[model samples]
Target: MWVRDDVCGLGPYQADLVETYWRWEQDPASLIGYGRQQPESLEARTEGIAHQLRGDNIRFTVYHLTDGTPEPVGVTTLLPDPSVRTAEYVVMLAPEARGMGLGTAATRLTLDYAFHITNLRMVWLKVLAPNKPAVRAYERAGFRTAGTLRQAGYWLGQVCDELLMDTLSSDFSPPSVISPLMP
Candidate 1:
């Protein structure tokens, strides 16, 4: 387990956790803030995880450390661009884990890993504008609003804007004392 603050980095994709991830993707409530709206089959989900594991992406399951056991809560990923020095960040937390500040902690930890361990020069993400809590969380993690793609997504029977945000290694200020777990 890779420890970081209150969470730990868990896997490349294990057979036992595939169903749990599929459940998260199928839940309509969880689809509100995400880009993909379609429900995926079990096989498709398994294939997607396998592809990610074999691709130029670094993914981890976020687990909240509770009492001595790590409870799985979410997932985070860094997809490297062709440039090789930059990447896009994506994170999703289980509904039960939201509002506990885990998102921010996990994001910070991920960013630290990206910049410090992987030596990425920049990281970016596009979030649905209506995801206010997530925008705030990203801002707290040092991401600046770069721009917006107007009416870029369809959700809840309406069009929504997508906010593009990014952060550079020069601008990131990692926690001085946190020891990030290296995979």
Candidate 2:
């Protein structure tokens, strides 16, 4: 397990966690942030998980460590572009896990792994322009807006711009510990 201060990396896809991912993929509410409205079938979800496990991507099931037992909150992935020593980063959290600081922690942890473990010089991600919270979280984790792809995604029943954000290995600084008194 890759341990950060408040989150740990678990599996590529363990047997017990497959159903959790399947349910997340099928729920419309969950799909909103994922930029998809079509629900995937259980078989498709299974196959997708299998494919990801076999692919070159580094994937992790993020678990929050605030509680005594690790509570699964989301997943983070780094899809490599070996030719350029870069990777595209992606993260998704369960609905119940939102509004907590878990997303930021998970992102930081994954970025650390990408830069340190994989020796990747750059990590980038695309976020729908309307996802303010996510944009802020990514910013808090050291990503800066690189550019925007106009009308590149259909989200919330309309074409939306996608903001490209990235952080170079040299630009990243580990997030500071959150004070308990702060929100």
Query: Which candidate should be chosen as best, given lDDT against the real structure?
Result: 1
Per residue, candidate 2 scores C-alpha lDDT tens digits across 1-183 of 554574554444464687786776566756777788677788877777777777888888888677788877788889899999999998888888877877787888777777766889999999999888899999988899999999988777989999999999999774533222246
TM-score of 2: 0.89
Which lDDT tens digits does candidate 1 get at residues 1-183? 654664445444455687787786677756878867777799988878777666778888888776588878888889888576999999888888888788887888788878787889999999998888999989988899999999998668789999999999888775622344333
TM-score of candidate 1 to 2 decimals:
0.89
Residue runs of model 2 more than 4 Å from their true location after superposition: 7-12, 175-183
* Colliding residue pairs in candidate 2: none
Taking all chains together, each candidate's TM-score versus the true structure is 0.89, 0.89
lDDT to native, each model: 0.80, 0.79
